[model samples]
Target: MNWRKRFRTFWNRYASQVLRKILPRLESMAARLSSTDDTQELSEILATYKMSGFPLPMSFTDVDTVIENALSTGVHLTEAKNAEFALAVHIHPYPSNVLAVWVYVAVLSRKS
Candidate 1:
C-alpha cells in the first residue's frame, strides 16, 4: 500500500474512535451554542480534545489556531440546526486551491 492509503486507513480508525468518545458532548454543545455563533467556545472544546492527546494531523497545532486560519482563508459553517462540526484543510494552492473538507451533520428529533 502507498503512504496515502496507509494514512487514510489510520485516519479512518482514529477519527471513528474520536467521534465515539466526543459525539455526545458535541451534541450538547451544539444545542447550547445553537442560539449564538460561538466559534471560540466550540474551538475550546476541540482544543481540550487535542490537549487530551488526540492532536489533529499536521504538526501539533491547537484546534483554535487551525480554525482561525481556516476562517481567515475562507471557510463556511451553515446555520442549519443539523450542522454539527466541520474540518477543512488546504492541500494545494496553485491556480486553484484544493480543500479537503468534511462536515458531520446529524439530526436529532424525538418522536412524540
Candidate 2:
C-alpha cells in the first residue's frame, strides 16, 4: 500500500477545502485595502492589522522579520514572540515581483 500517496491525497484535499473557505475572506480584505493609492502604506497596514477568526497553524514563528521585509519591499516572516501561531501575508506587485510577509503570534498558554 502507498501510504505516502494516500497521505498526500488526503492532505491536498483538506488543504483545498480550507483554501476555498479562506480565500473569500482574504479577497475581501484585499479589496478593502485596494482603495489605498500608496502600496507601502497598504503593506504596512496589512502587516500590522490583527487578523480575526483564522485558524492559524501551531508551528508558526518569525513574524517581526516578515513585517520588516514587507515594509522594505520584500516578502518574509516576522517573529512577534518566541512561539508558534503567525500571520502570513504576501504582497504581489504588478509589473514587479511578489513579496510575502509572515507574522508569528506566540501562543500564551497557562498551565493548570
User: In model 2, which runs have C-alpha deviations exceeding 4 angstroms?
Assistant: 1-24, 33-93, 98-104, 110-112
What lDDT does each candidate get?
0.33, 0.32
Compared with the true structure, model 2 gives a TM-score of: 0.23
lDDT of 2 by residue, 1-104 (tens): 23123122112232233334443344445557534233343243345343222322221235555444333431112233321222333333333343322222
Candidate 1: residue 9 Cα off by (Å): 4.3
Off by over 4 Å in 1: 1-12, 33-112
Model 2 residue 111 lDDT score:
20
Model 2 lDDT, residue 9, Cα: 19
lDDT score for candidate 2 against the true structure: 0.32
Q: Looking at model 2, which ten-residue stretch has the lowest summed lDDT?
A: 103-112
Clash count of each predicted structure? 0, 13
What TM-score would each prediction reach against the true structure? Answer: 0.21, 0.23
Model 1 earns a TM-score of 0.21
lDDT of 1 by residue, 1-112 (tens): 1312222211223334444445434434444643433345435445433311221223223556555544443213223332223332322122344322222222121122
